[model samples]
Target: MAFALRSLLLLCGISGLLTGVWSDLKVVRVPSCPKGWSRLDDRCFLVVDKLQTFADAESSCQGLGANLASIRSAVEDEVVSALIARFASTGYVWIGYNDINVEGTFEWTDGSPSVFEDFDGAPPTNPGEDCVQTYPETLSTWDDVDCDTPSPFVCAKDLH
Candidate 1:
């Protein structure tokens, strides 16, 4: 019957599509981070040796096709802190979050919403402290500091 034949052809086509999809998924590989960068989760991060103001640090990261590292989770915070410990000279490290545009409303440079925060002691209440940085005492915790303060910063690139 023609109807039976069409059904059989449809089933075969669906099976072929499934097989192709499975093969593609099986062959898909996560590319490694570039040399001198550390991989964590689905991103690559690097601690710049040079110290720069928060704005300059952001510019430097942009130059490398990355943005100042944004900590989205506790695991990411730990990883970035470890990277800073390994390569940073100064105690504090500039991150991507800032309340510059709106006081008390911190946002990442990449325009992502801030859902995770690990503040040290107390969050910045000082009017001049707008840029976020890792606390020296607790590397995982963050604090808002003056944006002009020069410090080494971490950069993050997404792994596509």
Candidate 2:
């Protein structure tokens, strides 16, 4: 009985050691958003109140290792719009959706597929209005405006 007890103790010790080593080898990393940015699942978003043209807004976002926000779903649209309303107040803010390269074929500046669109009422038929902007007060709705129009903007980046 004493020998069996000793064997059981030794087995438990070995099992504990293996578990510790395995846990040490499998270090898990936690994702986080940068300061002042909000996290929605795997992505982080930042709203800049400074007015800038579409190109300049994209440039600013790129400088921060991000891009102008490409809202892909209604949930994302709602969250982004809420962020704009909270941080940028009631106004239009530049998003990444645009049709500068091909009219009527709007694409995101970050190269994300334009999977979702929440245009406010009728879509723009103006030839010169290539960029897109979202008014927080209008909820998840968007509108097309000239790329040169100055507006506050949102930036988004994936968490590493």
Candidate 3:
């Protein structure tokens, strides 16, 4: 009986390690053109890189059958940020968040903003950067950046 318990514990540990490894390896996935999509965690996004301007990129996302990726939680925010950092997007992209409402407050098109934030120790710099962008963590994870600069944006959806 003890041997069996030990074996079971070992198996569970191995499974946990494998799961971590899998997540580490496949941090981001971009769907193929025409029919491919990128997936992070339980959400998926489509990227159309050929366009210029945040509006153009947004329209491009809509044309591809997806809206700009919206981060709702810290995890999703981290993931999106990672994607941006991996691709080295220095500017800003039109994320799902825009202050089209007031001028300072931002909300995702999904109707809510992710509780995540990327300010190191200070709040955002300018209200003009009211739009949202994603930045990466130590490796690559989503952190909020200004959306007005025109970095490549990510569009994501739940796989219902």
Give me the candidate number with maximum TM-score.
Answer: 2
How does candidate 1 score on lDDT? Answer: 0.88
Top candidate by lDDT: 2
Report RMSD (Å) for each prediction in the order shown.
Answer: 7.6, 3.6, 12.8
Candidate 2 backbone clash number: 0
Kindly report which residue pairs in candidate 2 clash with one another: none
Question: What are the lDDT figures for the candidates, one per model?
Answer: 0.88, 0.90, 0.59
Q: What is the per-residue lDDT of model 3 for residues 4-122, given as tens digits with 9 covering 90 to 100?
A: 99999999999999999988884566444334565766667654444355566667667766677776666766656655655543634456766656765656666654575454444
- Quickly count the clashes in candidate 3: 19
Off by more than 4 A, model 2: 1-25
* Model 1 alpha-carbon drift over 4 Å, by segment: 1-29, 136-139
TM-score of each prediction: 0.79, 0.83, 0.57
On a 0 to 100 scale, what is the lDDT of residue 68 in model 1?
Answer: 93
Clashing pairs in 1: none
Error of 1 at 157 (Å): 1.5
Candidate 2 global TM-score: 0.83
**Poorest 10 consecutive residues of model 3 by lDDT?**
139-148
